[model samples]
Target: MNDNFLNSANAPYVAELFYKYSQEPNSVDSSWRNFFNSLNEDDLSVLGDFGGPEWKKRPSNIIDEISFDKTIRPAPHINIESFKSSTLDSIRALRLIRAYRVNGHLIANLDPLNISKKDYHLELDYKSYGLNDNDLNKEIFIDGSLGLEKAPLKEIIKILKETYSSSIGVEFLHIQSPEQKQWVQERIEEVRNKTIFTPEGKKAIYHRLVESELFEQYLDKKFLGTKRYGIEGGESMIPGIEQIVKQACIAGVENIFIGTAHRGRLTLLSTVLGMPYKSILSKFQGYLNDPNEVLGSGDVKYHLGVSSDREFEGKKIHISLVPNPSHLEAVDPVVMGKVRAKQTQL
Candidate 1:
C-alpha cells in the first residue's frame, strides 16, 4: 500500500511477484493479482528499493507479510544479493530497450556522406539506466524480449544497437495502431533489420548497379551540355527499385503507379521500368515528338511517361510512370486519379 507497509525487506519479493504477475496474471494468487492491477506506476515505486543492502540482509522479512508460492521463494543456495541485483537489472534493461525503440533513430548512422552531426542520447546509454561496465556481463531476465528470456546486458545492448541504431534506423513507436507497431517491431527485430542475399541475388544487384552506372556514364558522354539529371552517386537505387517491384509482386500487388520529378527519371525508366535504351536514345536524338502537340513539337525526354508490364517469379504486374511537367511532384494527383479510376474499373 505505502512505503511503511512495503519497505526494502519485502520490495524485491514484491517486485519479483509483480513481474511474474505481469507475465502471467493467473500464476499469482487472485488477491495479489488484484492488488497489483490496482497499483499505478507511481504506486509501484515502493518496489524501488530492490538492490539495497538492507533488503539483501533481511530476506526473511519478505515472508512475514505475505504467503507466496514455494516456486516464488528463493532457494537456500541462491544468494539474496545476486537475486536482488538481477531483478533491478531486468527492470533497468527493459527501460533501456524501450528507449531504443523510441529514440534510437536520433543516434543512427544514417548520413551516407558522414557530414551530418548525430547527437548522443543519454537515454540510449546503459549508464543512464544505472548500469556500468561491471554490469555488462550480468545476466538479466528480459521475459522473451528480442526473442530471449535472459541474456547478458552486453548481448542485449549489442542486439539493440544492431536492430535500432545501425545504418537502417526505425521510428515506428509513434504508430497509433498497436498491432501495426508490434508487427513492424517483430519484423525488424526478427532479422535485426539486415537482409541477407544469396550469391545469385548479390550478383543480380551488382549487375543492376553496373547497368545504372554505365547508363549514367553513357548519358554524360553523349549529352555533354544537356541538363539530363543523372543518378551517378546514387546508382544503388536501381537495384533497390527492382527489389521493391519483386516484393510487391510477391505480395499480390497487381499495379504500381509512380510519379516523380526529373532526377533519376531516365535511369528509372531504362532500368526499372523496362524501357528500351534505343527508345530513350531516340528521344535524346530529337527523333520523337510530344504527343500533346498538334504541330509535332519536341518535349523534354525526362517528361515522357510510359506504361509497362513486368513479370517476376510467374507474377505479372503493371507499372505506370505518369508524365510530369517541370514542376516537382506535379504528376502525383494525376497518378492518384488514374489509380482511383483503375480501382473503379476493377
Candidate 2:
C-alpha cells in the first residue's frame, strides 16, 4: 500500500453509488440508468469487480497490481520487490501504485463521520502532562479529603486537561440534589467545586482557584454543567421526568418497570423516586451503610432502579424503577416482554 495511493479519496465513487441507490426508496430513480448505460465496453468493465480480492498485494508491475484491484488488468503473482531487479521495472511498479492510489484513498474517505478530519483527533499526547505527588500537598489528603478540590487551578487544569485533553466531552457528573429546594435551578448551577484548569498557566501545575472565589464573576454564564446525560448544568430536563416518575409512584403497582438508558436518572431519582443521596453516595464511597439495602445488580449511576409509593391524583401508585443492563435497545425488548406479562396477568 503506497501511502500516496492511500491519500486519494473514495468519496466520488461512494457518492456515485449513493446517488444511484438513493432513489430506490420508491422504485429506482431511473435518471442515472441510461447515463451509466452509455459507457463503452471497456469503460463498463470498470464497474465490475477487478476479478478477485487477492490482488491487492504489492505487484512487481505497479500497473498490473492496481489494475487487478480495480479489475482493469488480469493478475499474475510475481514478487513485487523482485520487480525492483531492474530500474525500468521499478518505475513501472511505481506507476501502478500511483494509478489506484485514489482507490485506497476513497475507501478511507468512505467513513461519513470522519470524512474531512485528518487522523481523527488522535491522542498524540506522548507527554503525560500532569502533576506528581511531590508537586502537591500530600499532607492535605491525610484528613480524609481529596485535595483535588483545593488544588491550585494550574495544577488542576494540568491534570484534567492532560487527562481529557483529547476527550471529546466530559464523561461524568456525580450529582446529589437536595430534597427541599424552591430554586432547584439555582442550586443545580451551584458549583460544588469550581476552578478553571488550563495547561498554559502560572507555575504550570501549582495553584488553587476555588469556586467561592470565582463563581459570582459569571452571573450570565449558561450551560454551566451541560452534558449529554446530566440532570442539571444540563439541569433544565428535570420537570418532565419528575412527572413520569411521580405518576409511577402513585399507581401503587408493586413493580414499576422503567425503560430508559441514561437520559436523566438523577432528577428522577432525587425529585421523582425520592431516592436518598446517602444511598447513591454510599455506593461511590465503597460502603453501603444500610446492610440490608439491596442495590440493583450493576447499573449505571443514572440507571439505578428505585421503588417508592406516592399519591397520584386520588390513588396510590407504587413506582418501581427496574434495573437496567448496559444494553439500551437490548433492554427495550425486555421491557416489552415485561409489559406483555403484566397484560396477561390483567
Query: Which candidate has the top score in lDDT?
Result: 1
After TM-score superposition, what is the CA distance of residue 303 in candidate 2 from its true location, in Å? 4.0
The C-alpha TM-scores of every prediction are 0.78, 0.30
Q: Candidate 1, 299: how far from true, in Å?
A: 3.1
Candidate 2 regions exceeding 4 Å error are 1-229, 245-256, 289-300
Q: lDDT per residue, candidate 2, 161-208, as tens digits?
A: 323322222222222432222133123223322335457543322221
Candidate 1 steric clashes = 0
Report the lDDT tens digits of candidate 1 across residue range 2-26: 1122234445566667667777888
lDDT for residue 272 in candidate 2, whole number 0-100: 55
Task: Please estimate how well model 1 matches the true structure, expressed as its whole-model Cα lDDT.
Answer: 0.75
Best by TM-score: 1
